[model samples]
Target: MKKIFSFLFLQFFVFSIVFCQNQKIDGHPAWIMQGNIYEVNIRQFTEEGTLNAFAKHLDRIKKMGVQTIWFMPINPISVVDRKGSLGSYYAVANYNTVNPEYGTMEDFKNVVKKIHKLGMKVIIDWVPNHTGCDHPWLDSHPDFFVKDSTGKPASMFDWTDTKQLNYKNSEMQDSMIAAMKYWIKKTDIDGYRVDVAWNISGNFWKKCIPQLKKIKNVFMLAEGDSSYLPKSGFDAVYPWHMFHVMEKIAKGTLNAWAIDSIRKQTEKRYPANTIQMYFTSNHDENSWNKADYETFPGAVHAPFAVLTQTMAKTVPLIYGGQEEPVLRPLKFFDKDPMEWGKYKRAKFYQTLLELRKRNIALAPNASFKKISVGNDKAVYAFVREKAGKKILVILNFSATEQNITIKDKTLHGTANNIFMGSTETLSSKKWKMEPWGYAVYEY
Candidate 1:
């Protein structure tokens, strides 16, 4: 019994240490806590699909209150076994240069300068886990690639267009880090949104990211959802688990109560300071899967977008053209530019962005408390409070109207509906939420 007790104590100590890892984040930019990222698919952002073409839209993007712009891979794509006429952006062929297809390196530098002139930070997509088959290193440094059964370089799982990089070589790690530094020095980019970050070894990131930070105190976002990525030096990681659960709820495979439970589970998975990038749609969702039109159609998109904007330890992302409500699946390797219809949803997103900028309670470090109301199975409600400011959010996830009454003191008192511009005495009123409807009240 004494031996069992001693072993249990040892296990508890180890578990506690491991659980506390993500809570002690340092070196992350202070500006990120309240940031809203706009992921720009440069190829589809405009008809020209060039760096110069995209440059013209910077003024409008900045006017929308976006703090950061995440540009997709801008490096040349390898033509050897390339997927389509344009090839996947992830199949990077060059490390230290811009893709001529986009424009000359001079044009990219000019674009970065213009973005900085507008006081917006730009982060390019960094592909580190793999490279295109035609990468020069394939011949000069064959050891940089993962070997197949025949002892030649191998492409990762049906990604015949690209080759997986071998992380075992220390020289390869140094070269990759140097290449990452080259971009910052050349383009003065704010940072990187590392692609397939978890596929590479964590130790390599532990070495590389700190070096990158020394050159510039930049924010790094990992494509992976694992807590290890955050620990390895990424400022934020994807919240794919929550995104999948949300899709399930939209399909009626789960109820609104699942959100409360899932929120708890997600919190347990990360440390106190871990920032998760939350979103309803992204590059993959917009192309590979359905856009918001199919999955979170109509009012369904609003509540989920609200959840991302108000959730704790999260930075929301809006893919380019979301404001225009792009209704089709964007082709990954083809020139299917978004038709910029009248910016109908521009004000809607602008309101959310401006609210996030002005409201301290909606920041990532604010206090979040779940509030239960009538129709608990269909209504998801919560309050985010910071200092003396409180914002109450009530979202009806079901496809029918929900008559909900507030019994909690959090909703008591007069508050303004920022969206509808109406004042309500919420202390005793029963409210009806339209199907897939949401309301935000600020006091």
Candidate 2:
């Protein structure tokens, strides 16, 4: 009995040690806590539309304070049921190979090396829920995909070019994970932005994510808003609810108070430490719904953009050509490069991004308190505080000027008006803000 007790105690000790190690790996990487991500649409970003061409702009992007670069799918596109001239980036034909159109695998490796050399991280878009019909798996492992009445692999939800993956098949799940692993091992990428992460089963993420982490402390961002995406091991999830609310607010269909409801809903739905990726526009919104210039047109876009950058548990995304203020819908499957302007919004984004890097108040885990400005309907105000640092953000969302007062006596102090580059005394005085005006203060 004594010997048996000792053996059991030793087993328990080993289990405890293993559990603690798993806890650390499961949490998000520390580097992303205060970082900003920039999405790179390779095909439309430059006229050449190649990795080598995009590499030339690294210094310019790095100067904009972008911490991470997320390149849209780099894999070869399937030609079997291709969408258009070039084809959708999501319709991936081969996972391990780089699209020759974008450049050879060596060219991609060089670009990744250049990005890292500039002290920025890299993440590639990964499509695990489905594959293009031209993928070898469709012919070699027929059972790896879902079957239709005709006994051939069926497409996923009108995406005729792509075939849905069979998650129930254990071998298929294993292959999908192996493909994901190959990229990290070969390219030394920092993480992945998983496409249609909600379509895959929870069990697969439960089984797949930890294995990927074992290889490297990779940051995973899901393109879905499902709560399980976070619980299953994703570091961040898409803010679909907040994105729609911002659009409605811009259209005058919703007021500033609507943001509060979404925040409350977000708080209750996801687990703690779950980051939300906030953005004004992305690939889907740019191609299908139109860019931010249409969604949050003119001066109306700035206030919402400010909110995304300063909000709690948020890592904001700036889509490619947003700095150029690209206004038209980018063709999804064709070659329509951005007409680069004078980078009209570069200074504006740089100020916000720099503040995020220097201010502890803007940290992902900071404490946020909503402040009731005079007009709750047209104006939104909030304070983020952390480690004895505080930042106050106020925005006028209406078409007319707003005269508002900060009633919190505790907030009256000497502060720096971040955008104006001036130090001012904050008091219980009424502040006049022009239409779509924004103010950020650090005390």
TM-score of each: 0.92, 0.94
CA lDDT, every model vs. true structure: 0.87, 0.91
lDDT of 2 by residue, 1-443 (tens): 99999999999999875564344322787668778999999999999999999998999999999999999999999999899998999999999999998999999989999998898889999999889979999889999999988988988778999999899999999999999999889998989999999999788999999999998778899999999999999999999999999999898899989999999999999997889999999999999997697988989899999999999989999998999889889999999998775899999999999999989889778999999877999999999999899999999888889998989987998999999999999998887999989999999
lDDT of 2 at 341: 56
Clashing pairs in 2: none
What does candidate 2 score on TM?
A: 0.94
Model 1 scores a C-alpha lDDT of 0.87
For model 2, the stretches where C-alpha displacement exceeds 4 angstroms are: 1-26
For TM-score, the strongest prediction is: 2
Off by over 4 Å in 1: 1-27
Q: Write the per-residue lDDT of candidate 1 for residues 163-204, one digit (tens) a residue.
A: 999899999999999999999888889889999997987799
